[model samples]
Target: MVIDMQKYFLNPVSHAYVESGPAITQKIKALQDCCLGRNIPVVQTRHINTKEGAKRMDRWWGDLITADNPLSQISNDLKCDKATIITKEQYDAFLDTGLEQLLKKQGISQLIITGVLTHLCCESTARSAFMRGFEVFFAVDGTASYNEQFHLAALLNLSHGFAVPVLTSEIIEQLESRT
Candidate 1:
């Protein structure tokens, strides 16, 4: 699953939100293309904030990522037309979303997680997936954040308990090698 790879997170203007966003966007697109070519199911998630819910998040992080904003739209580089797009209101993609049901419908028990804000949405969803009994292959370089330390922290924490940290290339190779 690609979590929060929208312009709001990936654009250079939002560097304060995620410094490595643009580069990570490219890495994620490459991974997405690899998955598409291999016929692997790819789920892309976008964070859409509601005005009412915005207040809560704003209190902590200030107003950002409003719904209907172009920033909230997924990056054009990542073609979600061939992927299942999931809209989320909070950090965890499965919260009140059809993610779990969709996964079940497709008999998908494992997920390769990639996207922006490694410590926030991506980590949240990874933990949630693990708690829900899904095997998580978290891409270390596939996820971006404000800095290398923050990104590594999330990878460390996830590798410790919630997920198995992997590289984008490794995942692409695995998918390509699969029948």
Candidate 2:
């Protein structure tokens, strides 16, 4: 599952989605396709702001993207029929969200995560997922951030702590072998 990758980045002040995000997006598509082929479930998490929840928001300057903000919509290519579009107000996707229930419902024990701002949402979700007992595969090439340091730092930390950091191609190979 890819974590909260909404439009806070589009605003000049909050910063647009990580610059090289297309690389991650491309990898996501590949994973999505593979998952679809194998009858595996895929979930896409979005961080949305409700009227009450939009208060503490501030990634760049003072800009905030609420749930109603059209910019917060998932990218066009990422809108998938089989993918569950889960929304959350907290940094952790599981907080007050049906993510855990959905995972249980889908019987998903293994997750391939790819998304933006590796240090923040990505790493947080990875840790939480790991703690929740999910086998996590952190897609290095399928995740990006604003700066190189932030991206690498999060990857290293997650790899050492909870996730198994692997390239997109490696994930595909693993999936193929399972089939």
Candidate 3:
């Protein structure tokens, strides 16, 4: 599951929000394109918060996902519907979403992760999945943050503590080496 790669990430001032919009794009089309080629299910968890959540996440609240947030919409090329887009208020994807059940139904043993805010939502979701005994493969290059330190921190932590971290190229190689 990809976590919180919304238009808000383009902003430079929002707390924990990174600059991943048009100027300094993060996601490599190669990885998403690979999934598209294989028909791999790529579920995106977007953060569309209520007014309460917005007030609660104040200062920390990223303006993009709110009702009035201008950047809430996902990128045009990578559009996701309500069904494919799991909306959640919590940091963990499993808190209120049916992500676990979806994986189980599809026999998905592992999750290939990519998106924005590498150290926050990505880290939180990775931890949740790891605790639930799901194998997680974090895509290093496909994910990004405000800076390289935050991005590498998430990768190092997930790779050493929570899950195995793999580069986008590595995933493509593995995917290709198999069928």
Model 1: lDDT to the true structure: 0.85
RMSD, every candidate, angstroms:
1.5, 2.3, 3.0
Task: Candidate 1: give its CA RMSD in angstroms.
Answer: 1.5
Residue pairs with backbone atoms closer than 3 Å in model 3 (clashes)? none
Tell me the tens digit of each residue's lDDT in model 1 across 1-179.
98988888767776345767777777788899888887778999988878775547767777757766777888888857789999888899999888999998989999999997898899999999999999999988889888788888998999999999998999888877886
- How high is the CA lDDT of each candidate model? 0.85, 0.79, 0.72
User: Which is superior by lDDT, 1 or 3?
Assistant: 1
lDDT accuracy of residue 73 in candidate 1: 83
Q: Best TM-score goes to which candidate?
A: 1
What does candidate 3's lDDT look like per residue over 64-138, in tens digits?
367467667565546744227888876777876888998889887888877776787788888888888889888
lDDT of 3 at 58: 50
Model 2 scores worst on lDDT over the 10 consecutive residues at 6-15
TM-score of each: 0.93, 0.89, 0.83
Sort by TM-score, best first: what order? 1, 2, 3
User: Which should have the higher lDDT, number 2 or number 3?
Assistant: 2
Which model, 1 or 2, shows the larger TM-score? 1
- Model 1 alpha-carbon drift over 4 Å, by segment: 15-17
The prediction achieving the highest lDDT against the true structure is 1
